[model samples]
Target: MTRPIAGWLSDMDGVLVHENQALPGAAEFIRALRDHGRPFLILTNNSIYTPRDLRARLSATGLDVPEDAIWTSALATAQFLTDQEPGGSAYVIGEAGLTTALDEAGYTLTAAEPDFVVLGETRTYSFEAITQAIRLIQGGARFIATNPDVTGPSADGDLPATGAVAAMITAATRREPYFVGKPNPMMIRSALNRIDAHSETTVMVGDRMDTDVVSGIEAGLRTFLVLTGSTRREDIARFPFRPSEIVDSIADLVDRVGTPA
Candidate 1:
């Protein structure tokens, strides 16, 4: 087996839980890692909630993750916008979480003649909103998005995510968005910087080959693909990207690492 990783970066939705419910062995795996003193952080493309808000929700679900240990696309997006256009006004197409993050980062969210057009997942997306966003982009607003995840797991089923909205805007305005979430090295860099982990010693654990695996490869970290979410065994042959390790789930991660702590 390969050497055990020194640090870990994991995706949340498909790897650990689905629809607010913790998956089998997820908590145990995390506890084992914690008991062994391994440093790990949850990296998620979902920008619907801040780290603190997610932490509370996870805690309520019995996950016991700390606020600082959670990294969301929202935080990364906020940071990216703040760096690119500090204190600039933006027309936001997302949820309360996206707005709150931008507010916290000192960005001015607006609806009219904004300097930038930021897009994310919205449950209430309407035709009028899309038309307005298209107009804004055409009228010289910078296009930005949290991530390119096409869909998210919901209780009812997979629902359109921020990527869908981003795609619509891209198609309408004929402009590509500056993405700030997973598969982008910026998110990985932010996580690594926060935990002070070297790329050589870090392992990225997630379920998707296109996003998680690709992101890890780009970030120069070992990648582990879990079969608990998006990628399935039958779909492996169809995947263009590859991971360094493949496991049944995060539950089996401890076994792959060797004897349990």
Candidate 2:
């Protein structure tokens, strides 16, 4: 028998859960991974919630993911900053997730001659905060954003995300922010490092082609696309790239667990 894949990575939304609802078979897929002792992480571009908070949110959706099994853009950004300049300071424009990650990485949060004006996802964006970020970036602070998602789905409708705000700041300062999330491939690489997973033996499952599939391919992992979220099967032909496998939902993947792609 062929050996099972050594590691797995999945996007949090669409692949596993939609909003507060668990996608069908998400729990089963996670259970299968756990049963086979596969090292895995649920990746997310959202940078507002801590891993513990995300664990609780997932649990509410009927999925039992451990805190250590969650990786967010906030964590990736923090790791990147630590590697670039250990113990540096930043003027942050995010919530607890970003702040906590930066703190744990030994970065002091400050607005006084900060190294970077770090931006992330948040429910509310104050004009004062944006103004400060603009001034900081224009004053020689490097601009860095957690993700480039322009819009996010909300209960009411679509809402402006980090990318939109980043654009505003860019327009004012004429300095573009370095996006550290998916589509850049750095996020995927950092996640693999977090789990000590080899790209050759790791499989990435995500619902979006632009962010998830492209990033996974760039990172040299086997990519699987599901039709439970952002991208539909019809949209597949539009993209220049493609996923290694396509399934209707996470349910179909449950039986394929422990089987090498």
Candidate 3:
């Protein structure tokens, strides 16, 4: 028989912290996981910041996760492209984080006749850039997107995410880009491989049913939905996907697992 999960794969934004604030019980729950020696990894779709940068930001908010324990779509995208073509070139329509990741992975960043067109979140997503990406894709370049999140949580409220930009490119090119973040099995597989964990022995925790819950289910892991960000109680009924469990916040997770201290 399968045992209760000995590890967890958690979403960063909505499940643990919302914006700059750590959600209720997030810190204590993390402490519990540490005390119990249960392995957990932070899997995030946000590609705007590096894992090290995100670790510092979360630490500043009192959610002490290690730099190496964090995995972002940016990193996964880099790994995927690197593995696909060891010394490939890419035309990136994204921010510093994505560019840095691709650069570190030995990908040449260019705008002309690249091997692939990479889409991620950018503060300055100009029409000119979109046109450029479309031209490249139409000219037979492969397309890859960091994540498929339509909106991102910000202090100013929800803003269009990288997926929105990807949609535009998809519309123009008539070809769907390969997604590398949540709701895609590639990310889960990468995380599991990194941690040396199995799907049956792992749990996925997040806020969104469509992304987090579905991803977990597809990966054959237990899924927990927290009502802290992106997803609300009312939205649960409308979501086509379902989680194995639903809690008010990460704090409630501690109460449920009661992992030995």
Top-TM-score structure, candidate number? 2
Taken over the whole model, the C-alpha lDDT of each candidate is: 0.84, 0.94, 0.86
lDDT of 2 by residue, 155-230 (tens): 9999999999999999999999999999889999999999999988888999999999999999998898999998
- Quick one: RMSD of model 1? 2.6
The list of candidate 3 runs beyond 4 A from truth reads 255-261
Compared to the true structure, candidate 1 yields what TM-score?
A: 0.89
* Top model number, lDDT: 2
- Lowest summed lDDT across 10 adjacent residues in model 3 is found at 252-261
Q: Write the per-residue lDDT of candidate 1 for residues 1-261, one digit (tens) a residue.
A: 455477889999889887778988888877776777777899888777778888888887789888888888888888888887898999988887788889999988887789899887777888888899899999999998989988877679889888887888889889999898988988998888778888888889989888898899999988989998978978878877678879888888865444522
Using Cα atoms with residue i matched to residue i, what is each candidate's TM-score against the true structure?
A: 0.89, 0.97, 0.92
Clash count, predicted structure 1: 0
The reply for model 1, stretches above 4 Å from the true place, is 1-4, 255-261
User: What does the lDDT read for residue 96 in candidate 1?
Assistant: 73
Which consecutive 10 residues in model 1 have the weakest lDDT in total?
252-261
Question: Whole-model lDDT, candidate 1?
Answer: 0.84
RMSD of each: 2.6, 1.5, 2.1
- Candidate order by TM-score, decreasing, is 2, 3, 1
